[model samples]
Target chain A: MPETILQTRALSVERGRQSIGLPDLTLHAGGTLALCGPSGSGKTSLLLALAGLVRPRAGEVIIDGQPLWRLPEAGRARLRGRAIGFVFADYRLIDSLSVMDNLQIARASAHLARDLDRATNLLERLGVAPLASIRADRLSQGQMQRVALARALMNRPALLLADEPTAALDEAAGDRLIDLLLDLGRDEGIATVIATHERRLLPRLDDTLFLALPAEAVA
Target chain B: MIRLRFVLQGLLRRWGSTCLTIGVGALSIAGLCLIFWAQSAIPEAVKTRISETDMVVGPKSSGLDLALCCALQMTPAQGLLELERVQARLAMDDVRPFVRMQVPVAMGDSYRGHRIVWTTPDIAPFYGARLTDGRTWRQPLEIVAGSEAARSLKLKPGVRLTSSHGLAADGDAHDAAYTVTGILAPTGGVLDHLLLADLASIARVHDHGGEHDHTETAPHSRVNAVLVRFTSEIAQASLPVLISDSETLSAASPRLELAKLMALARPLIDGATIVSAIFGALAVMILGLSLMQGLNRRARDFMLLRFLGMSRRDLALLSIGESLLITHLALLGGCILAVAGQSVLAGMLASHGLTVSGAVPFREALTLYSAAVVLSVLSALGPTLRMSIARDDEELRA
Candidate 1:
């Protein structure tokens, strides 16, 4: 219904001798995709390649109508910094910094004018506004995850790539996190792909791409 | 460009290691400054004290001992130059032809632990001594106190003090009363610690006891040394040798003796410089290692920064900037400590018989601080290189 914001064509990312292949898929504005697989299923490798962090061995990933692999490393980096946001399993927040500073880090690095108003709005939406002055190290895991999600939106990125973002949370927190991500995606018209082993999150996302384990261990 | 607040927080996060690194660097810088201060201050004080006088002729003794006694007043003259010998040198065809003026100094007497230097009236103007309170001494048993002597002993122009037999505080007291006629301004010279009297007055003060046994005989009287000013440059090269060759007396060029003293002290100065350099190198190494360790410890954070679009080059610069912060702070702290310590040292040395004056050597200070900064930057190479090549994706997992 909306414009296609992300797509992949015969994309295969190599890890050691094995490769992870993604079905030719298209995600439009406000669409959500879940990448589900067991450990060592190359889910992270495919995610990295799509995010321009890993070079694809074959095929291509296209984001916002531009072929990602065709760009040079610095160009790809610039695109990722401006157009893509990453959320890691552990939140990966700088412990020494306050939540407010952590959220503005990427914006500052990209030379984008820091919009404290946007940061405050996102933190309040995430229900972590009161913790903005607290150090990241002092926040609970759920609070840190919320802060990390706020940081991912600091630059108002068009695409968010989350890797096992809910793996460390309890079920109730995990359910809230997934709902919040979907809600944010819909409200902001941002495309999102979540990579997770959590089977419970499967029904919530708009689409699912299951990465099968290599044949050697399927038995 | 790195964010100053972020960099500061990065360092503060590891404040224990950071403070240790800073402590080592600060002490090293302080050591370097002290060595530089000593290398410059000792010679400067000597040169300043002897700037006016051209030559010092004293009894036959080590040239250093004579220079110390006659020029610096740091040591007493071992033996005396007979008044006849002094007069003979003044009249000699070889020495007299070049001499413009000579002031004979008589010692071996003290007033309240201050050495009484009995010399001709010319000694006052030679040392640039100005009367701070009263007039110059004009007669026997009358004295002019140096500024330090006046202040420490609380003596005014009209205060009467008796001379002791020798320089020691416990030396036998002479019954003859010496009147304080004037107090000299602080000249920042050996003269600051001396009580001044005319040669005739010293003779009269010592004449009271059997000590008169010698001053009573004028031509046979002994003067410790002679302070000489030559009319021409030729006198400096010829007169000292001509007088030193005499069996009864020794002559020393104040400038030449000062040069020799510096030459003798060169090894100690060199040793201090070497020690300070080693300390500086050691500090750099220690600081560099700590920085490297910090980089390793913060690999995860650095990777996160990379993910945030911080380039490899920026990370490297961040590493260097952190080192610069630590180094400059340490250097500033060390320099402040050194100046404070030096001032305290100056006061302490005064009581122990050394006179150091003026400010710390600023040029040397600037040079040392610049070198330390350069060293700090250079020491960052290891950590920066590691940062430049680090794989954020790999390091974050580790």
Candidate 2:
């Protein structure tokens, strides 16, 4: 039992009056976990809670042994930047910047000394290095997805959280991306948690957690 | 470095919106520049003529109006001073009188319906005028034309022409033919538009011919206004009283009149500047709104940067940098446009017979630039504060 990099116990989230709860999820270092659920089943909510992007209505989220919410706002933000990488479902690339600049910003934001060579290498590894100088808006969805991945890995974060990372890719491209993500996680010795509705991706995960619909809904 | 990259990327991505903002800013800047340039140029132009004149004497009325007419060549009110009385004042020790008559001469006849001004050679020298063509009026019935008048009438020296009553071609005609003597050089003064001849020429045409009557019994000659110069030793204070108390004359000082005129015009100038400033403030407000909206969209991006390890202070700095860059570029653009516009306007006014001189005022330019920068920064305050204080948790979701 290696220590968990992120642990959320009985976490609950409320939007308006509706509430979503995820119970006792523990993610250890150097592993890949998949969060599977149907539409509106709160998979995204659970992911946000673990990433420290959302405040759980109940219970606590401990990242690398420190209660994330207990820290000062600035302290928590610094921890997130240093330890976490995110691949948003929308691939939120800064469209005004070139692909290379996007990665550069991510690296700098992480408080890491800018390493142009490392950024170039990551872009090359993700097969987006050639598009590095092009504006993000000019790139296609697959290219943008790759650039997003490169940005996430720029700081070699302790944990990587991805939401529907393969949604915009074709089957062949999706598999390739998943393979790259897994390989990158293994190489960096970082934990990765992906939330998605795509069941086809289930076989590729190291472990799977199904977020069941609430009991009242099942009835 | 990463923050810089991100901001740059953001600007590029929304280039259409960015360009629109820049254009709006540029236009306001340009407009401010033009207004300041014109306002400053007018006062300088007025001052040039005022500095040249020792004093202006005219009928009792709005001193400003008289100043505007006599010194600036604006149309004067219909009041005539007796020419002989003015001439007598000039005869006093150390008094040099430069008398001018407003020959309401434009209305009678036009050579081909173009307007002509009937005046004397003193009209040219009184305003320090030069000839662009042949010569100033050397003989009676010989005319020295203004550039516009010359261009409009298509007249050259050596040509002979007739006059119409008043300034219109349809006005009554005077049968006497006058020869074009010399065209006056452009002085950017009121003399540009007047038709210059000897006082005898005007008297001859108007049939007011009479020998010099030195007798105190004679009625004073009919003339418009007179410009007087003191010969170093004669006190100006005594002259006005002496002229006003005399049998039939009133005198107005050019310096005093212009001061009064400027005082009356002060409120109007202040109102215009205030309105301009209000519009500028509104523009800044609009810029602030746009920036605030953009901050909302970039909230998640800011969080992403935070999550990547950027400090809140760094993010705040990035916002300020972006604004400063835009403001600086806009200010530069505005200054260039204003200077160019001023030169163009000055040239046009000179061509139209009003001499405008001196560069645009540096203080005015500085005022506009400072106003723009301050307002722009103030407008940006809302977004900058919002971003700086934003919670990381709130930003992560979007």
Candidate 3:
């Protein structure tokens, strides 16, 4: 069995009057794990906690044998750059920059050399190479999503995190994105975790975890 | 790379607001540039004229007033010295006097209602003047017209013109027509508006009879003032005392007078400059607020950048870069506009018979550029700090 790339124990997050908890979750290396839940089901909160972007109220997130929250914010940021990639639900591409500059910035942020060949290869594989020089503002929603995905993979991070990656796509496009993501993760031996409410994608996932609403409210 | 794109995209997306900020910043910077150019140019110009005379000796009144009248032709002297007494003083071993007799101003003259000054040949060399056409007055009744005077009077060299007694149209008639012997080049000084001739010509116009005869029995001296030069360095200190002790004479020093005048004027200039700087500060503050307000709209973009692995430091650098870019571009634009405006500024000064030197100092330009950079940095401070401080885990969660 591969080593665990991400492990969380007794994690709790609070926002305003609400709080969510997930106990004892671990994502092993070189696998695809799907986190499925309804809206406000604490799916994003869990992902943010795992990515070291959010500070949990209790417990800790351990990645590669390092306690993520125990490190300083800057150290966590560096780890995020080096060790993980993120695909946001909204496809948050910088609208002012060209597609190529966006990819280059991601590589640079990860402290990787800006390799045009690598960016081009990723764009071509993601079917966005022809639109590389165009501004992000000019791209359609699906195109921006692909570019976002390309940017996330630019640094070849050990782990990839996706937040509702297909929320804006049609059924056909969503299935294709999931297939591409799963195939890419398998081919690259990269650990992948995705937060979604789409039950349709569960059959494709190697493993699945259900994050239900807090037990008191559901009852 | 992504961080830069995000910053640039954020700027472009809000083009209207950004341009407005840049425009306001540019105007403030332009105003500062104008002040910078004028401050350096005015003093240097005044100093250039002052430098031409080693010393100015006149009546006991303000030294600056005497210098302005005698050397720069800006103001008239309060009193005059007797020519013989002046000549006797100049006879000293170290004293060299350059005597000038201002045409006894009668005030009521106008050729077709344009004011004309009746003055002499020595007025040209006394102020280091040159002729644009023809020659200096060689005979009584011959006139050398100032540039504006010639243009207004429509008188060329050899053309004859008449005058009234004063600047007014109803002043006494001179009867005899004075011939234009020369046209002076533009000096951008008081001389640009006067008519030049021999003192004798002015006396003749007033029909005061011959020079020595008119002076010997006359109730008053005809000359307005005399400018003098000294051969020895020590003469300046000694001469004023000597002249002041005389019953009929008092002396003034141009250098001392101008210095005193400048001392008095310094605070006013500094105050006005401070006011201008405050306006610039306000502009920078407004820009900062604008950036801060816009930051809220750009939060999603910033979060995306952060998610792509941009550190907080990169965000700060991006804010600074935007400010610097706007400021430097505005500074360059303001300087070019100032240069273009100089001629109009010089013309306005010339109309008032004030000479402002054409040369703008490099230091002034440097100060302007420095102020722009400083203001840019100051404007960026609020936004940079806010962005840096707000990059916490709670804020990024959504």
Candidate 4:
């Protein structure tokens, strides 16, 4: 029933002398798309292209009715800062900074007013509020992933791109993380794209995109 | 949107490297300041001390020896010039026309490690010295101590001290004690370290029994040197020739001699300056390399900042700001250390009867300080520009 927030048409990304193309896809706000693939299938590449971090060799990535690739890198960066939040597979938080500082990085880059209280509330919602003052490197992997999710939500972006968010967590923690991501999308009216190899998380999303290892990847 | 605190945090995390780099920068700056002090302040001090005297006439010897003994109270002359000959020449119509004033000085004694100088009362006003305590020396066996000599020897009005035979404390002391009749105000020159007395006092101390003697062996009557100020510019051309050719004494231009001496020292000064500059550049290079290497290791951190939406220009500025902060700290430390070092050097040279001004000349200091900053920033340029132009995720992928 919600309005469409993300759509891609004939998107093809060049990867080392070969091309990986995505099928035309559209998703509404409050919807979740689970992207599953084998190794070397270009799942991270596709997520990166959708997040305006990488350019596509052909076709268009449309987010909120704006052509993401048509904008210059700076323009695309601004759009990414304003509308897209990403959680990398490695949870690339600055090790020298504390958990609160990691979240403040988002607000700083997007020129948003620093609201530590709001970041703390999001951390509390993500169940890692107790680790707020601890440096990021001192946190456990599961704790780091949760902080990454909290940081991703810091800007309150409309579209969240999570690449292997629960790859290092146990089954129960992974399920809890998936439930939290889906519930946040439904409650905040966000469009979420999660690229993961875990098949268990596929059925819980609103829709799924399956990718196979490319012929060149095998060669 | 790059907060400077992020750069600060990164530096603090690598505090060891940061402090070592800053220390190197500070040492280089301190060395440069010393060179600047030498190249500018010392010569200026010499000029300030000798600017008034036009010519120095002494026993025929090296011009340097004449200038040093006559003006700076440095080095002893070979023998005294005949006072009668100088007097007879001054009485001549030809020489009297060019000579505005002539103050003859006699030396050969010391009091508490300070040179005891003998000259007439006319020499006081010639050097712009005034009595800050008591009256000037008007009687034999009475002395006026300069401000520094009075303080260092702990002499005041009415205090008495025995004079040594030669210009050193190791010499045998004379039987008679010279009364400190006055104390001269600080002139910020070699005079501040001299004990001034009338020529009669030195005559009494050396003669032990003679009175008003103008004999050649009498140290007081035989002038060691004469400080002459010309009334007209023509005196410079006319007088030295008239004195050196007609008389058996040397008439050396004090200013010319000082300039020649400084010129002779130019190579040494320039060499030291070059070495200090090289150290400064090396320090800057090490600082730049350390910061750049640190940045390499923290490439992912910058990538994350870019991912969070900070622009590359802001990143570059942040890096530059960090370097500027270190350089500013080095500048401050260098200035303070330079002052301390200059004071110590001035103190050591005071014992040699040389004046070194405490203040570093502003122009040279500014040049060195500015160069330090420029070199530091230039060294950081390559790394900052590299960081700025790098594509997002390039560092992360590497």
Per-residue lDDT tens digits for candidate 2, residues B117-142, read 44445556556777778877666788
In model 1, the runs with Cα more than 4 Å from the true position are A1-12, A19-29, A58-82, A104-108, A111-116, A207-219, B1-16, B110-114, B128-134, B145-189, B207-220, B352-354, B358-363
On residues A1-219, what C-alpha lDDT tens digit does candidate 1 reach at each position?
A: 887888999887776588766678788888888877777677777777887877788898999888999987667767777778889899999888899999888787656777889999999999999998898999999999999998887888788889999989999998999889889988998899888888778888765444343522211
Interface RMSD over true interface Cα atoms for each candidate: 2.0, 2.8, 2.5, 2.1
Winner on lDDT (2 vs 4): 4
The 10-residue segment of model 1 chain B with minimum total lDDT is B211-220
Task: Report every candidate's CA lDDT.
Answer: 0.80, 0.67, 0.69, 0.79
The C-alpha local distance difference test score for the whole of candidate 1 amounts to: 0.80
Q: Residue B102 error for model 3, in Å?
A: 15
B98-214, model 4: which lDDT tens digit per residue? 778888888877876888878889988887889999999878889999998899889899998998867767977778889999999998866788898888876578766653233
Write the candidate numbers in order of decreasing lDDT: 1, 4, 3, 2
Chain B, TM-score, each prediction?
0.89, 0.71, 0.73, 0.88
- By DockQ, the candidates rank as 4, 1, 2, 3
- Judged by DockQ cut-offs, the docking class of candidate 3 is acceptable
DockQ of 2: 0.40
| Quality of model 4 by C-alpha lDDT | 0.79
> DockQ of each candidate's interface versus the true one?
0.46, 0.40, 0.37, 0.46
Candidate 3 residues A1-219, lDDT tens each?
887788888877754556776667777777777777787777777777788877788898888788999998768877888788899878888777789998888877766678899899989999999999998889998899889888888888778999999999999888888888888877777789888888888887865454444422320
lDDT of 2 by residue, A3-82 (tens): 67888776677544677766676777777778776766666666666666566788888888888878775676677777
